[model samples]
Structure formats: C-alpha cells, structure tokens
Target: MTCTLENHRAELASLLKPVFDSLGTQWLPVTSEQLCDRITSEDTFAVLPIPAFTNSQMDGYAVRSADLLSAAPDAPVSLPLGFTAAAGDPQLELQPGTASPVMTGAMIPAGADTVIPVEESATGTFPELVRCGHGTPSGQAAFTAPSPEGRFIRPAGVDLAAGALVAPAGTRLAPAMIAALASSGLTEIPVRRALKVALCTTGDELSNGQLAEGQIPDANSPMLAALLRRHQVEVRTIQLPDDPQGFVAAIDELQAEVDLIVTVGGISAGAYEVVRQALSPLGGNFHHVAIQPGGPQGYAQLGDATVLCFPGNPVSALLSAELFLVPLLREFNGLPEPRPGHYPLAAEASSPEHKHQVRRALIRDGQVTILDPGSHLVHDLARADALVHIPVGVTQLVAGQSIETWSMNV
Candidate 1:
C-alpha cells in the first residue's frame, strides 16, 4: 500500500528517534581557529564589550563639541594642540580649550565628546609630530566646521556589551560568527558532535567498472557518500551482494559503528530484492510513498541501529536523500530547517496524477526551468541547482505558474 509522503517521512523519523535524541547534548569543543562550519551546541557570551572603550572613528582631532559650537565656514575656531594619539596610544585627558589629534581607533581622550576630521582644519593634514611635554605646537589647528556631540566617536559597548549573548545555541559557525566570538574574547566553542552514517548499496547487476551487457555501474553509493560526507557526517560504504545472507552480514558488521544505516536498492516488490528479503523479519516495513522517482521507501530497526532503505534507481535514491534523509540528518545535528521556495516555472511541465513529482531544475532570475535526461538518467542531475516539487493531484504545471522548489546548494 502507498503511504502519503509526509506520513512516510514521519515514520522514518520515528525509527531514528534514539539516534536523534542522543545528539541533543552530545558536544565537543572546537577552538576558534577551527570553528568554521561547526554547529554550536550552546549559547556563547561576550567576555568584554566590543571596542571596550570609546574611540575615534576617524584620523582627526578629538575635541569637545562645545569647542566647535560657534565655529563655522566664515569664522573657524582655533585651539592649541594638546597631544597626538595614534591607535593604541595611552589615554590622556584633554586640557580645556585645547584639541588633541587622534588617529582612527585611538581611545577618545577624557573631556572630549567629538572629533574634527583633519581635513576640516586649517592644517588640512595630520600633524607630523605631537608634543605632549607640557609645551603646545607653535601653530594652532583651526576647525572650519561644527559637528554634533559624539560625532565620529565609537562609544563603549556600541557594537556589543559584556556578557551579551552573541551566538545562540544551534547556530552554524560561519566566518562572521567566528570573528564575533573571537572579538568577544572566546577562544573555544561547544559544537554538536558530527553524525556518523553507513552507506550500503545492494544489487546483483551492479558494478564499479565497465559493465557487461546487462550489468549497471553502482552510482547510488558514491553519490550518497559524497552528499552525507559534505555535511560532516562520517560515512562508511558497504557493498552488499544480492544474496540475503551477505546483506545481513554486511549490516551486522556496521551495526555498532554507525548511528544510521542507509541502503540503496533491493527493497521494492521485485523478486530479487535482497535487502527486504533479509531484513523483513526484523520488522522492516517496505512500502511505496506518494512521490515519483522516489516512491519505494522503507525503514527498520535492527538491534540498536536504524536502517533507511531507498529504491534502486539512481535518481530515486539521490532524490530520496535530498527530500527526506538529509533533512532529518540536518535537524538531528541542530542545523536550521530547510526552507524550500516557490518560483514561477519558466516552461510547462507535467506531474504524476497521484504521486508528487520532483523535477531537477535550475532557478534563474526568479523562475525555475526543468532539466532533461529525466529521472532514470543520472548525469544531468549534477547541473541542476534545485528540485521543483509538483504535489500530488496536480496534473500539469503551466509556464509562469509558481511551484515549490528545494535548493540543492546544501
């Protein structure tokens, strides 16, 4: 009997519950330098405020806003230079009626609440040297304009404050997050443990090399392996014979090592389906799903491991992974949920009457265009950046009609 695609997905998820639950608190420490692409397991806080102190945002003079309140284009104010401050210079108080030259990122001196850019002064450039030895420069710097208080000053804690929540739990660490963590004085991160998966391909007619007249090369195992490994899931590929005993042995060997077992092929109604024949007694519920190119799907519990079964066709196996297995694995690892989008079809397409059909598509300029070589043909899938979903009961999709699409980028 055929099950709705959603029901089948939920059933498969239920079978893998134990593995998914184990990942909630399972975490490991990753240093900031190695945090890229890792999924955070807990919220991280800033130890210190970003910038830590008010600083100058421009290479100019630090002055009190009151000093330049009356300064204008026709009547500019002139003040004796108090000192010159480059980035990292020790903080010094600004003497009254005097201005200090401060470079970008230099701490704003006490008693100063504004910055006058060097170009806005009569000097038209930064001072070559600053005398902080109680003697002022011979010529005074004229501020030709007036700016509001706090202008060009980066106040303390403006970007981030101490103890601020920076990265919340379950965030995938990217370059920006890593930089934020580092700037917040964090050196290490707690990240979810990488998932481990076992890949097994079953068939008597499968080969890795040049095929004899009736033999087909095994494409499912390698494709699934790459897809899983790309997401940091550890994958071990197992070759299973058409013999039921061999298939059982292979699964038994990998039972203790992997969190989940994904098998491609031999679960359909055909007589030579070795996976179903061997594991049927173990409670594997082989059934068809209301989805085209990936209708035949099943899952079963063997001892402590969960085995997810996909159909023999390359497109079906890969599409099953993208549509069902990968999403579950991503959720199990604390990754954000996938958000499929809807786009207008660039051309007309047909859908199966009862099953949800997925066409490999390219989304360009807000429209989705289907690719050729169809479902059984595997090579053209590489060029597709997305999968356009045509739901059950929808017979045809006219050009310019909008349909849901799943991105294959991740």
Candidate 2:
C-alpha cells in the first residue's frame, strides 16, 4: 500500500521505537574541553554563577560610583590612584575617594561599584603609582562622570545564576555552550552515547570494476556517511551487488552491529530490485510515497536492526536521506527538530500534477530558485543548499510566490 510522507515517518518511528527504547538512556562522561557536538542527555544546571565573582568589564579604574558622580569630560574629577587590580588578583579593596587601576576581567575590589575605561579617563594609560605620582592624596587621576551604579562592572550571576538551568535536556553542546559550562567550572559533562548506523549501497555497477564500462561509482555511501557523521552518528558503509542472497547476507552481518541500516538502491519496481525481493518476504513495508525523486521507499525490521531503503538514483537517494532519515536520526540523538522554512521563488517553477515535488533549490537573500526542475541532475543538487517542496495539486508556482523549503546543510 502507498503511504503519505507523514504516514511513512510515523510508521518508521513506531517500528523503531522498541529498538531505540532497548538502547535506553546511556550517558558517557565527556571531557568538557573537547565536548563540541556532544548531545546532552539531561538538563545542565550552573553549579555556580558564571563569572563567580563580580569583575570589571574594561581596562580602567575601579572606583566607587559616587567618586565621579559630578565629574565631567571637560572638567574631570581627580582622585588619588590606589593599587592596580590585575586579573586573578585576590580580595583587594578600593580606598574611599580613590581610584584603583583595573585590567579587563579583573575582580572588582570590595568597595568598588563601577569601572571607568582608561580611554574615558583624562589619563588614557593605566597609571604606574610609583613613577606617575609617587604617593600621597595629591597623586590623583581624572575620570569621566560616573554614568550610573554598576557601570562596566559585570555583576556575579549576571550571565547565569547558581543552580540556574543553563541548558535544557537534548541540547547539542556547541562552542558557546562549552564556554558557558567551563565558566561554571564544569570539567566533564554527561553526554548521550552516539548512535551506530550501517550504510548499505547496492548496485552491480558499483560492486565490480565497471566504472571503465561507463558505470556509476558509489557516491551514496560517502555522502550518507558524511551526513550521518555531522550529527555525531557512527556509520559503517558497505557496497554490495544486485543479488538477493548477497543483500540478505550483508543485512545479517550488520544487523547485530548497528542501531539502523540504510540501504541505497534496489527498492524500486524494476526487475533487479534485490532489496525489495529480499526484505518483502520478511515483512518489509515498501511503498511509493507521495513525493517526487524519492517516491519509492521501504522500511523493515531485521533482527535487532531497523532498516530504511531509498531509490538507487544518486539524487533520489540523497533527497530521501535529507527528507526522511536525517530528521529521524537527529530526533533520536536529542537534537532540535528540523525547521521548515519558506522563501519566495526567484523564478517560475512547475511541479508534477499529483505528487509533492521536491526540487533542488538555491535559496539566497530570502528567495529560492529551483536548480533542477523535473530532472535528476546530481550536479544541480550539488549546487543547491536547500530543497523547494511544492505541495501536491499545485502544478504552477509563479515567481515571487512563497515556497516551503528544507535546508540541506542542516
């Protein structure tokens, strides 16, 4: 039976739930220093406030905001220079009516409530107390009028409070997230274990040395592997010929090793459709989805592994993976759901009468231009950054009309 796009996805999710649930929630301690792209299994709380202590946000003087209350740039207030508060200095205090030189990120002195950048002061340079003025209250520095209380002073907890929920569960930690965690003194983090998948490409042309005879090389394996790797999924790729026994044997060998098996080719209506023949007897659900380029699709439960099959054409296989597999894998890996974006068509485009046409598109500056309409040009797909999806029954999409799109780079 034919299935709609959502029907197939829902079915796949239901069929794969048992397998994914069996894997359970396993977490590994990942070193925070190298945890980029790791998915968090649980919400992360800030153990301590980011910054931990109040600090200066500029290289200037740390003084009580009151000292420069009435000061002006033309007629500046002069005050005695106190000690320098460099970064990492511990427990220093600003003297009353005095200005203490502070480097950026230096802890704000106990009595200081404001930081005036050196450039805003009469003396643009950080003063050397010994050489500039020697000693006494007579040694003074000019400052701009204090803008307000807490000026240029990054208060403790300004960024994140202690015990605050910094990252919700399912967050994929990037550089900024790592920095925030590090600032809260996190040395290691609990990240979800990577999902293992087997990528199978079936075609007699690819299995043997037929490239010299004008046969297509195996491009789906590398492309699919890279796509899976981008989301931190471990992939094992295998290339097999158009033989039912070989396909069954390949599936048997990999079912126990991977969480999912994705096969490229041999699922269409053609005579040499080895994958369809091999899996259909074992109760694989194969159908023509209401989508172009990737109409022929199949899914099966083989022992412990879940299998997803795509059509053999290079563009078709990639489109299938981008539309169906990527989002599924991302959801299982605790990443955010793929967002469907809309952009105006840069030029006129046409779609198939009954099927939802997904055309390779180049989206730029809020406009999407179809790269290959009603064609399976792999080069055009390469130039595309997104796929323009025209809904069924709408054959014509005029220039400047909004079209729904899925980003390929994601």
Candidate 3:
C-alpha cells in the first residue's frame, strides 16, 4: 500500500511494534557481565558510599559544650588532657573535668557530648600537644561546658539505610554507576540484547572492479553497515548483484536468520528496480510518499522477517533509514526516547505547504542550522553533524526562526 511520509512513519512504527511486544521470554536470562558487550546508556547514576565517620569541620578540643559555657578568652577553660584523637585514629573518651584532643574526622568516643575548638581551649595552637598544665581547669571544665547527645556525629543509617534502593532501575550504568552496581553486589546487568539486522544493497551498477558505462561503485552497503553499527545495531552486510534470480536466491537464504532486513537500493520505479520486482513475488511494495529525497521507499515481509527498503541515492537511503530504521531499532532495544540535538537554520529553505521538509544541517547552540544536501548531491550529507526536519510547509526561515529538527547521533 502507498503511504504518505507521516503515514509511512506511523506504519513503520506500527509494523515493528509487535516485534518488541511479542519478544518471547529469553531462554536464558542475561546477566550484567554479558551486557558489557552492548549496553550503552548515558543516564545519571546515584552515589555509592564507603562508610566512615568523617572528621569534624575543624581541629578542636573534644568536650561537652557545657564545660566551655563559662569559658571566655580571659578565663579560658583549661581542661586536662584526658585523651587525644586524630583523623583515622581510635576514638578517645574523655573523663570528667578533662577534654580530649581531636582532629577533623576522629571518632567521638563515649561520654563526649560536643567538640569545643582548640582555639577555645588554652592550647589554641595546632600541631602541638593538648597541654593541660598543672593549674589548667582540669577539674572545673566538665562542669562548665557540655553538649547535647548526638551533636557532631552522623549516626549510621542517617543518610540512607542499607537496602533502600541504593541503585534504582533505569540508570545508565556508567563508571560511577559501576560503583553503585558493585556496591549493590550486581556483577552483571540485565539489559536488552543487541538487535541483529542483515543488509544486502542491490545494484548492477555497484562494483569494486573496473567500472563500465552507467556503473558506479556501491557506497550504500558499506556506508549503511558503518552507520548501523555506530548506533549499536549488530549488522551483517551483503552486497548483491542486480540479477533478479541472484537477489531472490540471496534473500531466500537470509530470511530465516535476521530479525530485520534493510536493502540499500533498487526499490524505485526504474526498469532496473529489481528489488521491487523480485520481492513483489515474496511481498514488497515501492511507492511514493510525501517525502522528497526518500520519495520512493518500500517495505516487505519474508516469513517471520521484515525488510525496510531505501532509495539508491545515498542521501535517500540514509534519510529513509533515519526516519524509519532508528525508531524501530530503539523500540527493539527497549531504549529511552532518542535525544536529538538542534542547530540554527542556516539555508533559506522553507516550505509554506507544510510537508515535513527533511534537510541536512549542523547542530549549533542547541539549534539545527539548515544545510540542504541538494537532493542529487549525496556527498553533502558527509558535512552534516545533524539532520534537521522542517516539517511540512510553513515557509521562510528569515535567517533565524526556530524550526524543529531531528538531530542524528553522527
């Protein structure tokens, strides 16, 4: 059936829907270790902590704040040194009428209520011993300054109780996420498997050997394969000669193995449109959509597998893949919605008729700046960092009117 571009996109999406929905339960569930091969997400992960009692905010005397209540500069309280504590050292418990020397992060032992700064103590000097001299307030300090219970200590489970969903699902496992996952004791991730797709771009014109008249080297097959793998699709590519019997025989051998099949060319109206003709025997259709570069696109079915066919022109082939193939791959992979960047509209190409105008562009400052890869000039596509879609006829982008664009991950 002939489909308008929008209708085709909808149909394409609909066609692949069941493939995902009916994905049978895996015979063997995948583990995190197995996912290292294909799982790739850019999602943020939560923090994984290594437990420790951190140092106090400053170097100070460990005492009950109350002991220092009456301790002013002139009559600075001098608590006898009961014990001393430093970061990463043993907790020091102080006795009544005395204080312990403590550094930042030292554990507060039993009977200590608060930490008074060393500055508040007679020994305000740092890097020195806790000097509790003979006349120091060894006997009076505890009675004067006291702190409330649990003042400076971070009680266990205060931040996050263990087993409290430390690592939530849907987080893109990254390096930091690796820590969280490791902390969660997950050595392997359970993720969707890499989709396997097969490709066979057909044309009599394509060859690596010396070219004859009207023949051009095949760029679409290799290029498409490269493009597919870049976005994480595990692709198997085959180049077929233009002969109808040869193509049909090739497909007959491929259908049972692939989940999806994408053909590069020969689905157009021309006499040599072998794919449209040969696949018609096995069910494939090539018809015009309301799209320019990808006007002649098609789809077909071979038993359990489906084929998405694109025009021979590299631009057309790529554009068709972007619009049709990407959504399908994403659906198959169970990935989040594709994130597209935007560039400013550079060229003055606008369609007042309001049909989706798919153009090439470079994304800059979160906008898609337009650049037309003149329908015939497929090479121009190489210069583009993104693809901008000026959807259907709202003509005239006066140098900088914001238009929605679909940015590819090129």
Candidate 4:
C-alpha cells in the first residue's frame, strides 16, 4: 500500500518502539564529569545537600541578630571582632556580643543567626586587627543599622536537599544538570547505552578517492553518519558497489553487530537496484511514500537488525534521514523531538498536487523564503536553515501565507 508521510512515520515508530524499549533496560555507570548528553536509565537522588552546610552569601560579618537590635545612625553599637572566617576555614563559635568576619561561601559559625555585609559597617570593610592578648587579634565592628535574623545567610539544603531527585528516568542530562549532579556529591551516574548502527551507501559511480569521468564522491555516507552521531548513535559506514551478492554478504556480517542498518541508494526501481534485490527475499517491504525528494523508501527485519533504505540523490538521502531516521534515534536516546513551527512564506511557491513536498528554505527577517525544491540541489540544501513542508493537496501558496517548517539548526 502507498503510505502518506505521516503514515510512514507512524509505521516506523510502531516497528522500532519495542526494539528501543528493550534497549533502555540495559545501562552502564558513567562518571558525572562525562555525563553530558547521556540519558538517565533510572531516577537518581542527591547524596548530599547542595552546599552541604549553612554559609554566608557575601563577604560580611556574621553576628547574632540580638546584638544589633538597638543600634542606629545616632547610637551605633560597637562590638569586638573575633577571628576572620574565610571559605574552607573550620567552623568557629561566635563569642557573645561580638562579630566575626566571613567571606562569601564561608561556613556560618555557631550562635550566628545573621550576616551584615562589610559595606553596611562603619568602616565599609573588615577591620584590620592587631595582635592582642592570647595571640588573638583585637578589633571591633561598629554597626549603625539592625539586620533581621537569617539575612544574607544561605542555610543548608537551600538549593537542593539531600536525597532529593537529581534527575528522573529518561532525562537527557544537560550542562546545568551535570553541575547539579556534581554539587550533590555524585561521582557516577546510571545512563542508557548508546544505540549502534551500520550505514551502507551503494553506487557504482560513487568514489571517495580521485574520480574519473562520471564518478562522484560518496556524500551520503558522511552526511548520514554525522546526523546519526549527533543523536548519539555509534555508526560504522561501508561503501558498496552495485553487486547484490556483496551487499547481502555485508548485511549478514553486520546484522549481529548493529541495532539498525541504513542504506542509501540502490532501493529505487532501476536496472541496477542492489539493496532491494538482495533484501526483498528476506521480507523487506519496498514501496513509494507520498513525499517528494524521498518518495522511494523501504524497511525490513533482517536477522537481528532493522534495515532502512533511502533514495540515491544527495538531497533526497539527507532529507529522508532527517524525516525518517533522526526522530527515531532522538526518541531512543531520550532527547526532545524536533517540533515543527509555523512561518510565513516570503514569496509564492507551488508543490505537487498529491505528494507532500519539503523545500529547503531560509528564515530571514522573520519570514521563510523557499529555495529550490529539486532533490539533486545539494548546494542549495546547505544554505537552508529550515524545511518548509507543504502538505498533500497544497498545490499553491501565496506570499505572506503561513506554512509548517522544521528547524535544521539543531
């Protein structure tokens, strides 16, 4: 049966959902330092409270609130200053009717319930003390204003409490989440293992080295490989000729080593279709999808791997990978789906009457201008930052008309 673009995507999701679900059950421990872009396999909790203890939020004087209750500009309260408390210093006890200098992030001492920033004191800075009796420095801090209890004091667990949820299962860890995890004293995290893929590009005219007449460099393999890697799929690429037996042998060798097999070219109806000829007898379903640039598509279950086939043109192959395969890999890796947005057309455009057409476009000055729609326009595809999707039955679009678009920046 001929499938619409939406139907094809839904079918692919249904076929691959179970495979990814099974893979999610397996996980490995990764260091917190290296957990960026990794998905959590299970809910993780903080081992310790963020900050671990009550500390000062500024460079100030730690004092008992009661000591400055009656102080004012006309009648300032002068109290002897004790030891200076800098960050990493051991906790010290506050003496009665005295203040202690405390830098930002310094642990608040016992009996100190409030902090007064250095600028709020009479000197506008910490007092320079001179050695006095008992080898302790002697000085005094004069306060003219009263600060309420708990002011400028960052209490323990103020950011995150011990045993609180750091991240939930299936969360893709970002940089901020990694910092939070590290602050919680967690050295390791449990993350899902990455999915593996085998990428095969087939054509007799494709070559990576010096080319002769009618020979072109293999562009699909590198393009697809980069896209797959960006979604955390470990990829191994192989270039194959128009020989059906060689393609079949390659699939046999890769079936046990990869979770998916993606082939570009050789699936369309032609004199030298290699992928379809080799995989059709193994239950592959090759058909036309109702989408331009990437209409000829195929999928199959071969041995222990799922196979996907795309058209030969550079633009067609890249568009197919973005539309069909990228979403599946992102979902499997717990990354957010690339949602489509609506934008106004910069100029008039037309699409096929029955096929959903995707044209390269650029968003400039808040409007999207459609580029060339040819499937072989590889250079035009590079200048596009968005995919303007004109659905089936949308034959004509006037200027200033809003159309659905998927961002290519991600």
Candidate 5:
C-alpha cells in the first residue's frame, strides 16, 4: 500500500538488506589468461610475472660511493674508464681502480656501488695513449680529491618489495592493476556471480508508442530498462495489458526466474490500474506515496519477488527508478550507499507540499544548473545530467543553493 516517504524508504531498505547481506557470493577459479569482463570477482584470477632485469634509469659513471667524498669541482679526482655498461646488459664489474660508464636501468656490477652524472666531469681530451689512472694522477693525487659514487644506482627492490598486495580480493582490475598483480605472482582470482533481473512493462498503449486517440507510448519501461543496464544490471523485458488476472498470472510465472520485478504505470487510483490490481492479489497493495508527479508509486511482494511500481509518466517513472532502484542495486551488489553529491541550482523553482523535487539540469562550469524550464515535463527528465533533490519542508529552492544531485550515468 502507499505510505509516507520515510516508510517507503524504510520498506525498501528492509527488502534490499537481505540481498546485500546474503548475496553468498561465489567464485570460479580461472587462469589469468582468461580474465576479460570488468565485473568478475577480482580474486578469481592470479598472474605469474615474467621477471627480468632490464635497462637503466640514466647514463653516468658507476663507482664506489666512498670513492667520491673528497673530490671537488676545483681539484677533481680521476680514474681509468673501465668497460661501459649500456642500457640493457647484465652487470659489468669494474677492474681494480677503475670506474665503469653505465647507462640508466643497468644492473650495478658486483664491485661498483654508485653513479655520478656526466656533467660533473669533463671528458678530458681523448688520448692516443691513455694514462694508467689511480686516486687521480699519482702526481695529481697529491692535489685532487675523490668523488662519491653510491647515490646514482638504485638498489634492487627499491620500487617494489616482493609479494605486495598488487590486486587483492575484490579488486577492480585495470591495466596497472593487472601489471602489479602479474608482478606479484598471481594468475587467477575469485569473484561474485552477477544477479539476474527481468523487466515487465504494463499497458498496451505504452508499448505501441502510438499517440492515437488519447493513447500514450510506452516510454517508461524501456527507459527504466536502459537505466538498470547502465548500472550493470542483468535485465530482460516483457509487456502486459490492462488486465489484472492476466498480469498476475504473468507475475506468478516470472517470479521464480528473476531477483526483482519492476513495472511502469497503472498504479494510480484509475480503474485500469492493472499492475496494482494484479500485484494486490499476490500480497501487495497499490497506494499513493506522499511525493510528487510520481506520488502514486507502489510496492509489494509479487510472489517471491518484490515489485517496484512507478507512475506512468516518463519523468515520474525515471524519477521513481532513481529514488528507489539505484540504491537497491548498490545494496544488492554489496556496495555502500552512494554518497550524494551537489552542484549549484541552475535556477530557482517551487513545488507543492513536502515533495522531493527533481528537475532537468546539466553540469556547467563545475556546477549543476537548469537545462530547461522547471516543468514536471516528464520527457525533459531524459535530458538531465543529474537530479537536484530539494529537501523536505523547504517547498521552494532559491537559485544558487548547492542542491544535491545523483548523477544519471553513475
């Protein structure tokens, strides 16, 4: 039956709590090579990293750090150049009393401990007969100091200690996550199975989408389907007419197959409110919610499944979905209720009673502003980038107040 806003929210929360709490998630072990879809339980796959030592961080001479402490720009120290280590080679040990020219990312030789940038010393004119250098020229050793060599070469495991939490259970893996996971030696993970949903649209006129002789097209059902899908919900659809018995039979038939049932229209006090009438026979009652253009919302058990009913108007249908369905999705998926975010109101507007108002608005200059006239203009809701929630009792919103909006594509 219809109830206060608070009651409806409470009812919804209760019905949804078990879905999140008892999801009883399962995992199927699969090879890392098989990981594909973004929603798989991240724990199901593990990766085995292909490890190899590679290129340098930069090019410079590698030496022992203790060797450079006394060297200065004025009276520089000098040593014989040993074999050069290029970017990708294995470590090249320095001969006794010699410095090795090394590229970035190269492994340090067993004996060398540091690197000094090339800018610190001059190449000193190429000599046909190179001098046997030690602690600077022996004659110059009396005058020159030694330069430090330890700062340049990065020690092994500096960037990553072994066995890190690259991608733990429940991780949402991306390229970087994959790289990290592979690096940490994993190949598979276990994840939760997806929940299945079915959409049953009521009213023949709405389905036809033909505006003939006061008839209306069925916009709400399809729109609702799209919204659910955007949230990664598994959904399918069926349509019904304005006959209570037939609709009830259909609900009876489908309840065993889906986790939830959502219907659009025919919940109001009107005579042809077949969805309400149909659900009423199966443990539910159709009643008016104390809200707005969509106040005529309904809910009840449709056999084993809970049915969320929305007003027939397109805006009302979508608004109802936003207010009720999205939150349920979050709970069912074992995720926290989304934090409500806000942007400035585009323009000031007023509504009747203590109803929560939703209007068409887009994000402009980092703020939410009205996109169209503040009309209950049902169709206009489709154009909205966000929903501006007017709080209870205010009855009016002055422009520029940073009202809360639940993003549409979230």
Candidate 6:
C-alpha cells in the first residue's frame, strides 16, 4: 500500500526497532581527543575535582581576606610580597602578614583565602622583586580596597567534584564535555561502536569512472556514503548491475556482515527495477511514498540485516536518506534528532495537491529561497543548504510566508 511520508517513517521505525535492538551495544575505548561526537556507552565519573585544587582566577596577589580588611582608598595598606606562584608551581604555605604573587590558574597557597587582581592593586601590576633580610625575593603590594573571602579564587571542586558524574550513558560527547572529562584526569572513555551499513547503488547505466555513451557516473553511491559517514556510520559501498539475480547474489553475500543494507536506484516501477524485483519475492514492501523528489521506497529483511531502498534519481535518493534513513540512524546511534526550523520564504512557491514537495533551497538572512524542483537537478541540489517542506494540499505560498525547513548541511 502507498504510505504518506510520516507513516512510512513510523513503519520503518517499527520494523527496524528489533533489528537494531538485536545488534546490541559494542563499546570502544577512546581518548578525549578522539571522543568528540562519540556517544558514551556507559556512565563516566570524574577521577579528580575539575580544578583538582584551589587556584587563583587572576594574575594577582593571594592573601588572607583579614589582611585587606583595613585597606581603603584613603588608607592603603602595603604588605611585603612572598614567593611568586605561577601555574605548575608547587603549592606552598602563605606566611602571615605577607601576600603571595599568584598568576592565573596558579595553585592558591595554603592559608590564602582571597585574590586581589593585579590591576586592582595600587601599582596596577605585580611589584618588582628585591632581596629581603631572609635572602628571599620580596616586594610590596599595596591594596586600596578590602577583598571579600574567596574573591577571584577558583576553589577545589567548584566546577566538578571528585567522583561526580562526568557524562551519563547515551550522551553525545561535544568538545566542551571532552575538555571537562580530560581535566578530570580521564585518559580513556567508553563510546558506542559506529553502526555498520552496506550502501548498495544498483543500475546498469551507472558507472564510477570513464562513463561510456548512454552511461552516467554514479552519484548516489558517493552521495549516500558521505551522508552515512557524517553520522559516523561505517559504510561499505557495493555497486550492482540492473540484473535481478546478480543483485540478489550480492546482497546475500553481504547481508550477514552488515547491520543494515541501504540501496539507491532500481526501486521504481520501471522495467529494470532490480532492487524491487529481487527483494519483493523475499517479502520486501515496495511502494510509493507521498513525497516529491523521493516517492519510490522499499524495505525488506534479509536474515539478520534490514534493507532500505530508494529511487534512482540523485535528488530523490538524497532526500530519502535525509528524511527517512538519517533520522532513524541517528536515533539508534544515540544522537539528537535534527529539528526542523521555520523560515520565511524569500519568494513565492507552489506544490502538488497530493504529495509533499520537498524542494531544495538556500537559507540566508533568515529566509528560504526555493531552488529548481526537478528530481534530476543535481546541480541545483548541490547549491542548496536546506530542504523546504511544502505539505500536501498547499498549492501556493506567498513571499514572506513562514515555512518549515531542514538544514541540509547538518
């Protein structure tokens, strides 16, 4: 039966849910540098506090708050400065009645409860060192204002405490999260293994190189491969001829090795529709989906693997992957679903009465300008950064009318 685009997605979800669940989880150990965009397979904990130790948040003086209590603009108090504490310096104890020069991120010495930024000091910078009676370099730091306790100090565990949850299971690690995890002394992380897919593009007229007369260079294979790779899916490309028997043989050989098999081309009602011809006898459901550019869609189960078939046109295959396949793939991979954004139309547009028209468009200046609506317009598709969705029964759209768009660059 012909299904609407929404119904097709729901059906695909229901059919593939078990196949994905049966695949189970495989975890890999990865370093913080390799963790970006990887989904956490298990709960991760902080090995140490984020700061690990109290540190100065500014290049200034670390002093006891009581020492600055009497200092004011009219009655500035000067105290001898002790050792300089730069980042990576060993922690030391602050002597009474003396201020310690501490750089930003420097460990705050014991007994110091406040930091006075160098800019706020009387000299507006660190004082020069001189020899003192004890043979240690010393300098004077004058404060004109009292510093409250803990001012400009990043206390231990202020950002994250020891043994705290760093990232929970199913969390997609971004760069900032990786930084936090690395700062907590985590050297290795557990991330879910990438989903494995076999990308098959079938058509006798398609060639990868040196196309002869009546043959076209295969765009669907590479295009779909890139889309799959963007989602971190491990894809193995298989180019099949229009011969149905040969197609079945190729699929049978790879079905056991992959979690899902995605085929582009040869799924329509044409005479050479190898994908539909080969898989339909094996219980594949091939039907038209109520969507422009991509109407012919099919799915079948081949033993442990599930198959998803798209039309032959480049634009149709691309939109099919974006709308139907990518979302489900992201869902199973623990990634967030791509949310649709609404933008005003830059110009007037129209759609058919029965099928949702998914037109390529350029979104700029908060407006979406629809491009050529033809399914064969690969050049136009290349220039598009978004897909503007005009639903069924909406025949016309006026300029400045807000419409839903899905970013193609995502």
Best by TM-score: 4
TM-score of each: 0.79, 0.78, 0.65, 0.90, 0.67, 0.86
Worst ten in a row by lDDT for model 3: 22-31
Candidate scoring better on TM-score of 2 and 4: 4
Candidate 5, 301: how far from true, in Å?
4.0
Name the runs in model 6 displaced over 4 angstroms: 22-34, 66-78, 129-135, 144-146, 333-352, 362-372, 394-404
Candidate 3 residue 79 Cα shift, in angstroms, is 12
CA lDDT of every candidate: 0.82, 0.80, 0.64, 0.86, 0.63, 0.86
Note the clash tally of each candidate: 0, 0, 35, 0, 29, 0
- What's model 5's lDDT at 41? 49
Q: Please report how far candidate 5 places residue 321 from its true position, in Å.
A: 1.9
Return whichever of 1 and 5 wins on TM-score. Answer: 1
What alpha-carbon RMSD in Å does predicted model 2 have with respect to the real structure? 4.7
| Pairs that clash in candidate 6 | none
Model 3 lDDT at residue 263: 85
User: 205-268 in candidate 5: lDDT tens per residue?
Assistant: 7535547775676666677888887555668888876788888878778778877778877887
Question: Predicted candidate 3: what Cα RMSD to the true structure?
Answer: 7.1
Write candidate 6's Cα lDDT for 276-395 as tens digits.
Answer: 999999999999999998999999987876998988899998999988888887887667766788999999988899998899999999899999889999999998988888888989
TM-score of 1: 0.79
- The parts of candidate 3 lying over 4 Å away from their true place are 22-178, 207-218, 331-355, 362-370, 390-402, 408-410
Model 1 weakest lDDT span, ten residues long: 25-34
